[model samples]
Target chain A: MNEGTTVLITGATGFIGGRLVEMLAGRARVRALVSAYTRTSRIARYPVEMVRGDIRDEAAVAQAARGVDVIFHCAYGSRGTPEEKRAITVGGTKNVIAAARASGARLVHLSTQMVYGTPEKGVITEELPRQEGGGTYAESKVEAENLVEAAAAAGLPATILQPTAVYGPWAPVWTVGVLARMREGKVPLVNGGEGACNAVYIDDVIQAMLLAARREGALGERFLVSAREPVSWRDFYGSYEEMLGFPATVPVRVEEAVEPQRRGRRWALPQLLELAREEPSVRSRLGNTFEGQLARRLAGPLFRRRSTPSRTPELDKLRRLRSKPELPVYRLSPTDASFYASTARVEIGKAQRLLGYEPGYDLRAGMELTGEWARWARLVPAKAEEQQAQQKRKGVEAQ
Target chain B: MMVGAGRAAESLHLPAAAMTAQVTTSVIADRNLERAREVARNYGVEQAVAGAEEGKAFADAAILALPHHLHARVARELLEAGLHVLVEKPLALTAAECAELGTIASERRLVLEVGMVRRRFPALRFVKRALERELLGGIRRVTLEEGMPFAWEVTSDFTFRRETGGGVLADSGIHVLDLLAWWFGELEPVAYSDDDMGGVEAEVQFTLRLPSGAPVEVELSRTRELRNSIIIEGERGSLEAGLAFGGALRLDIGEAPLLIGQAQPHASEAGGDYQNVRELFIEQLENFRDSIRGTSSPLVDASEAMVAVGLLERLRAMREPLELPWVTANTTRAA
Candidate 1:
């Protein structure tokens, strides 16, 4: 974007939208349409004009969209019921589209590759037929894309970007969530993690977004944005495992993992303890009780039942000593297994050809960045200790 | 008079003032007169005013519960009007501003207590006494991790703005820093970093050296749930305490963890028994009132609260972009 360009970003508090605001803050007159419910700490550091309102509010959308050269419609509901998701994804896009059309501004819509649903074994492209029944998130995203396509067809200058498995710093799913699961040693691998992962770094998706907004040819088009090569799930998760200085994750069969979930016995004692440990409200309530105190005392020995030693000889003893006692194994559901087992590689050649978008970060580079953030964020204890040592050295030097 | 009918005022200050026998609910002032009226109606406050200037005339002392940036200016105005002031924490955005307000209050002989209600927590007070008595022996290192999802009902987006003194370090971390200063002696900055890429930081990690040369490692966040506890390792034993007002202190000296001071109903100085945070707020309000009357000194005066603000200022000045290798890698490649 040029210096004089004015842009309004919806979902400016979210991972992608927050990063966009960071990137575009000084380059353009950035205006963020934030919801009151979402914390504005992420975007409040910048000089962006923040307008608090939900995307469902049409008047708020129109007001925020006024005098903007472009509108980046990145806001979509990821939680709540199907109706709520549709209201935000489908309904919110309708409001954004109307605002963009009224203001004669280009619209850059962020869609997901999940819109393709569980595809058959083949390369997936933008021309592939959109599927439904994937889940609420995927279904709603498909509906949102349809609206964007309709708007583009109606002569509104708009482009839709379908990014595959966007992962990097601040990414809730592919980066942070994956690291959390791996750290917990609960990530289940379906078919030994052989499925194709069309993982793209967040920066690459953002680069595609910037290109889509600027290139005239990008209008009236849906671009599939991803890294140049698809990595195996083993490699994708293994990369994070390596970053955390941990051994490989043990793989389990899909059926073996899904059996307990199918029987509705997911909330076992061990899982409940894990949940109580993670949730503040649960911990506060349960921890105050005498039984909770007893359980807290016994939890170490109970969960730390000796298991088969790790296959990795060098790090097995260190891992055993340092890691929390092995909690119950977390298994992937049938849907997650299907998605992880898919071999369809997403094609981003159209984005490269049309918008001149090139994937800047490979999987290794992306994970490296994510690992750096995890360490800085204190998600990685090993790195934190190392950082502490470095800081102590710096202290000595200062003295 | 409560000068800001915002969340802290509505939830804590006004409710605590109603329970404070020495104080009366006089006036509620806010930029939004409707909000002031609503809060005043709920608390049985006598009047509602548009701003602090109008509300200052209604009461002998004023509780400045306004936004962070407005604290210095508004408190200065109230102090100049010969009103005792109990402003919220981080009395001003900078140590200089805090010192200026402290000077104003000192010259006028008005009570200028900062609303650092955590200092009034019985558990923390117990820890302070334990430290003073050398119960944990000589301190070696202290690690504090306090974080939860940002759920405080903020009336506006001021908490996220840098100019408005928003950020995890300045907002919540101030309390942690103050506790360190209160328990330990002076602090020397070692290293500081945060995840601020131009916006207010949701996460921050910093190290400070106590006068005893022991390190204090602090990790604060507004995005995720952390351990939310402070652990002090000393020569003889370690002390672990929860960050919350109701959080208990646990002595880890024995074979098993020993609970020391849990948040039981405790007797206030005013001959009443209350529980947890509400009790602490009441005690703080009482302290403010008594300080104004010269019966007792403020528990946390402006000069004492300035220690945290000064540390904050120094830390911010010394902050390095918490090294995100990936961001650097990408930027270098692009260059």
Candidate 2:
């Protein structure tokens, strides 16, 4: 496609989509298709031609898609009201693909790295299976991506760009909001976050999107676009500490973290018992019958004749533990904890090597820029609230 | 040079209402001509107001922005001259001196206002409103911590010398002491200790009883890092406002949203100490203007200002550098 080729983009008012419009505006005849709700004066100030319409509106999509050779479908929802996420990330994608097909335009569908389910190794490539039993947002993205893959297989000229945690100008998530909270001592790292999260600056993602558009080989394939390295949660937060000229309070450990959970469980037990007693069966003899029914059904299956014939003692012990209330079980592995516990880091080497990606901003520089904004806003202290509060707390604690 | 003045004039532009007719002007009366002229130029008053004969004609009101010892003499002169007076506080070095001004103001029926600009902060107003509404029900105790870093670090002529009423208690703690008196009424005498470090009183910790016998503690320090915070602990919640580095007031009421009082921005980032202190000075000026017009009494009047002066004099006498300190009772009751 030529630089002046008419390119219609859905989700153009969103974080990634907004940046994509700005990046692609000078290079092409950009027509942004934004939902009526997300439209603003900020979008109007930009050079791109903004068409007031939702992606779910077929007629609106068709009108936007008319005469456009390339459709950059860069919209998705992460943090929004539930109704918004449903209308945008799920129904929005369906509308975009339909529009693209109607105009016979090539589609570059922007997906997320989140669809790749929790992995044992923190290294997630395009080949990883989708996470099972993810809630509405994740499940919807998985279904949407599956549709895109099917469309590509059916010979539609389509490409998928799954970028990891994107940061820079116009980033909605993991932007200055999270940084501001962290600077104010509001966000504390909980659960030992061993999971690696990959970040790509907006400039790099734009470059990746352009490269995907020009290359014929990228069609009918998926690419992971992110910063070359994954930052661990400790080092991720240390960037803020470096900016503020303060030493990091030692990383909170898992056992210490679990202490709060244990306390919460103890506090909740009384409330749970009150709930149990208020039930109709609990106040009658039916409570005994309920316990008897539970034991008859559960005990016989565990004490099966074949249980003694189990080959592995570990499996036998596992079965015993399943029946026992006192035995403890660890449902999450360290690697899984890393993915769900702290922050997840992605490895974007494939995108870097294959897609020719290079990020413009580093984590330290980004954090310094973010800190400058925070200081100007007076969202956090300029110099000494922390130090003063520390001394006061120490004095009070000593007393 | 002219352009800089033009810009400064534009930057200093107050609303039309802020500029009232100069009904009562100051005979600023400083031997230091440069400082006096600077104050005059900033406030847009004439320079002859400082001279003795022309002083009374200009002195509808006298502003004693002089050292603590000089306040009583200046006040007595102005009061005798039949000019309403506003003085920078510790209204005088002694209770006797404070009472002299108080008696004169009472006799003349002229307003004698003391400049305590902390009360002008929006956060403090928010706190006072909350207290009135009983949001934090029946405020029982207050903890005040005040300091001026200059007292500890600098050996300057004004602050380091004790004869000028240069102790940390007089310079900074007086503000907190007066605020405590205003915040929790009917201050009953109680136990206190003074930690005198070197040339002046380095720190003083006082325990007082409210009229209702609620215990209030105040710790005044010149030794450590600078901070000014008053935590008003009420029956239901508490409010904390302080002179943060940026001169901010941070308010907290249990799990409720924290309302902060910050210096109104002049331009850009509202840079550094001069701007913050200058704004506070302007607030006091406005309040003084209001008091003269009978719109409202200036927040810190002579009576309240004298309480701080009285407390400081008693404190200076008691500063024996105690070895061990402890309070007998730490309890709060309904007011």
Candidate 3:
């Protein structure tokens, strides 16, 4: 399918799908199927047709899928309750695939490496069996991919692209979130930041997804599209501090990373105990108010106005050992810490040889490009290119 | 164009060259020749040298993104070779070292900028301009606080060394300290104590007297998160300069009680990147480039960073050291 073909992008207002619409606008007849929740869309600027519909709604997916030669299914829930996740992932995929089948359109399904269940093996290839337990996001994605594989086996022209930790200009968790946190002088590095962050640049993933549409060898195949080399979360993410223009500090060992089991007991047990100690409704309200006032009175000393030498004598200061008046450091949910620890590197030779995919952007280049967009958007403050141009002009004057 | 092709140079500072007009990396030198070559390749730099000596002719000026202890040594070499230089913070470990470097820059007529990134924040810049504009009265009480848990991935070992001016104080504290000096002129350290933990302090608390007799209380940490803000009480009223970088200079101004202060969050906006460090860093570079072009002196000079280092040196000297449990984990990445 080329310029004459009709293409429908399910999550056209999203980061990846929006980018795809931009790339494919002139190449084909592009129609964007954006959900009502698409707050802001760059695709709205393009000449493509807009179809407002939730992917989970069968009639909406079917109506939008009508007359399209290629359906690039990319929408999924990033946030919601558990039932909503399943509806967006498994239920939504089922509706999209059925529409694609009904329309005889080629389905280019966007899946995630999360299906592999945070591999224990260092280098995962596509041949490995799909592990079952990676929470709702992974499990739901796996269920969707399973439906895709089944549809392909039943003779629907379909392809699946499993993109790894996709990060770019607008990728919330990776680029924006990371840069945002770096500004605050904190990045929660799990397991001393030694875990693999199999980060793939968005451009690379886009290229692979595009190639999946046209490549003859991609029929009925699942491809893992990622950077050739996996970066250690430290070397990969630790560099964010230096890149974002802060002096690098020794990463503090997160208790959640090093001692996750005990952290649960330390955190949840007290809350559970407090909840278990039931009182009459009126007494509970009064006790809560009293407790809050008492705690405030106790913490009053910490906020006291001080303009003198520390009262504690030198060497006898053990009494105030852990007493500090500052902000609480970066705290991650135990689940998040575990996710950081379990991130795995994988081989992408299948994408290279089969789909003719080349992982063009390394971690540095990817981050640099993201920084460029961030600079354009005024997220990051430093500008090296401007400085370079000034230097060139100065050299011309000197010569 | 840059020395020390380590993590900082590779990430924030290196990319910053691309963002600024007159600044770009022509060559990068690192201890590891391959690493230098790799950085040069990644950033599209033309030449990758093995050491500082080999990169002398590549660019008009150089940014010293090296570690804290190595600033003066590397800066001196670059300065003597007739290269304009920008040194990263804790400009040098000592005032005398910074002075020596400053003398050379003066003799050579080369611009020597210091990498005090936070000063470039819109909020802090606004705060300084407000003080200079005399819209606010004489300083009364200053509270400089930043608390966030220690959660960065540290790769290099030298950052943990005491001689190198390592730990949270030098790494994160210097920015707040330099900002304090920038706003209030100078600070006389009345009291300083830190959770030394043997190698370096993870947390520090200080009582400083500003020139206007304002007691500037500072708290910095890599252990806990604190309200990352600056509160100033003047003769007329008080203003809180909150959200230092990549966000608004959230200010609240009122008479006696700040609780009754007017919340002027969107009072001033439109920084390069109000919420990102890169924009402030770019602003700093832009100022440095302008200084190089004879527009004006940089917003922060070598002296500003030197004052911060001097304070750090004094704090370290007066420190009541406490030992933290010595434990090391082999956290090398699995193959």
Candidate 4:
């Protein structure tokens, strides 16, 4: 099915996008859309038509979408302002969808599990309602996916593959960030780090993206892509040390210093911005940013350093609900406590049943491959050439 | 002085230098010799040096990987030494400095190129060609919006500090702005607003007017999420370019969007469709080389760099500050 198919892969220099280019190199005719800052290292190895233009540009996307059979829309930005994110995520998707529609090509979009907003309780599925509040990054993804859904409703051929915490080669944020923190003895456990984390290896996610491209059933459908086993945050780091054969490094509990105090004085805030401003106009004192801050702060605990109780009624109540703990790393600040506290396992049943997607690598094998690639990419240390050689001889960790 | 040994140098500059026909990395410089030496070894450069002077002594031109604030001072010193210079984008923290550097490069007769590498991409170049070809008729309006989650695993402190020319506008905004200038002359700002919250702006929106009264809108950020692309609305039709994967340029004339052209990874002079993004960097380098050799001007010269930086400063001046409970979500990687 892959033979003689023309494909377009956007964000080709990014971690997942880079891998997609490598995997699809010999399989099909590929066209790549990358950014100005994109380095050549990830993409130069493959033979793909590399285009440079912003996705917000309708003309540029239309130009790239010409003559392609299917497009692997694997590119989306996670960090920017609300309007900027809306323009790119929601607006950019519209452009790609239009391009795909114009050319009569199918789209395999790479999305994230954050659309469901890291369910704090149980396994999240494709059927769950998207969060009304998933922070800026997650919120924007929800908007982007909505655009894709609207396009599909209009008869645009497209499939959405939402992956969980993906870690692997050149994963500048997840894999490398974690190892760097761990090796430097900056491992901190927020709320004891016991929350579930669903991680899918990079290659596995790449496999799912490719599968969704060819599978007819995948079109007009949304699939949750994750691994079979979901591990806790502690086990996640523990496995890293074990795979490297490094002695166990204890995780520091940093609950008190980071988590917000929840028992202080209370007030009602149904609409945060409304309370912030006396006027009803958009340009009033309470803007989107102001309202957002007011609402989020009122709804969540107030993060602060632990200190002696003032002995007042409200202060005592707050003190009773809060306690202080050590801060291991400045990098692992209060937000991380919330992140680690809120993580929930995601379900990949849809990907499994529809796309026949199954993870080929367990945590052990995935980390091994990731380690090998990380070492080659110079993102992690290779203690010895012998240790590097030992990876090939090693097998999957005992389940 | 190439003050840092981070991604831009490792993944981009050196590799592209290797691909340049006559260009070869002569010096690898960084505060960290370990990284510098390793980088030198990877690219087969002859010398690996540390600190400011030791590094600048070996190369005829230095790619300033230093923090943004340091670009002006270091480039001036190198220029006095009769050396050419290529500074990373956002030429300097402000517009005046960029203009001054452009003046110095001109007086020195040395090639000074800002690595706004997008102009070197054949696909983007194709968009410029199509626009010039009037495929999209008369330009009416243009919108350039690009945003990504700021998840770059950078260990450099300079990237975070606003005084040192860090932040979303300086880092990500300049690239998109440079491209905007290239396609639609210097975009004049009509109004500007941003959500900076006393830190670097995570998001910015610009109401701009293109050359000949084509209204343009520009959105840039480091806080929220989106796809990076530009949409140009012209008289006859429209154009869309995806800035995510190298770049993909498309055109539509009344009917469904037609994929009229794609990026030719190399400029033919970039030595035969070199397989990697090195081709774009290599093409940029070749432009620098040709400019120095008195063969051609830099593809994105210092003056062009000044235009983007200058406009950026004006926008920053006009941006209304925002107030939000800032989350100390790790702004950078903790290596």
For model 4 chain A, the run of ten residues with the poorest summed lDDT: A281-290
Which should have the higher lDDT, number 3 or number 4? 3
DockQ scores for all predicted structures: 0.23, 0.01, 0.01, 0.02
For residue B266, model 4's alpha carbon misses the true position, in angstroms, by 41
Model 2: lDDT of residue A253: 36
List, residue by residue over A1-399, the lDDT tens digit for candidate 1.
777999999989899998888778777889999887347766776788999888999999999999999999999997798899889988999999999988988999999998888674699998888997888888988989988898899899999999999998889888878877776654656677888989999888888889898998898999999999999988998888777776435455554444333535664568755755554333333432334445657874653352233345465455345433343345566677778888889988899899988888899888877887776566765575787998897556434
TM-score, chain A, per candidate?
0.82, 0.69, 0.78, 0.76
Candidate 4 lDDT tens digits, A1-399: 354888888877778887776667656777787665324333543455667778899899999989999888877765587788777777788789999999999998888887876556766889899885766677777887888888898898899989888997667677877766555543544555677768888778887887888787888999888778787877777766654455323333443323223312332343332433432221111212223345445753431221222335574344223311121232244445556776566778788888988777677777777666555334455657656665543222100
User: Against the unseen true structure, what C-alpha lDDT does each candidate score?
Assistant: 0.81, 0.59, 0.71, 0.68
lDDT of 4 by residue, B227-262 (tens): 467887777778887775346667787876576444
For model 2, residues A1-399, the per-residue Cα lDDT tens digits are 456688887777676676565456555788887655223222332345667676768789889899898888877665578677767777878877787788998888888776886554546788777775555666778877888888889888888888877775435566555454444332223343454657766656667777777677778878887776776666665665554455322233332223222445553646534633454222111112224335446765642432223345574455344222221222223333445464445666666666555655566655555555444333345657766886686456333
lDDT of 2 by residue, B71-141 (tens): 77877877887877767667888888888888998898888888776565545454455566777776566
What stretches of model 2 exceed 4 Å from their correct place?
A37-39, A78-84, A183-186, A190-195, A242-250, A255-345, A368-399, B1-335
Worst 10 residues of 2 chain A by lDDT: A280-289
Question: Residue by residue across A252-284, what tens digits does model 3's lDDT show?
Answer: 344422322356556564553343243222112
Off by over 4 Å in 3: A37-40, A247-328, A333-335, A384-399, B1-335
Q: Which pairs clash inside model 1?
A: A45-B198, A45-B199, A45-B200
I-RMSD for candidate 4: 20.7
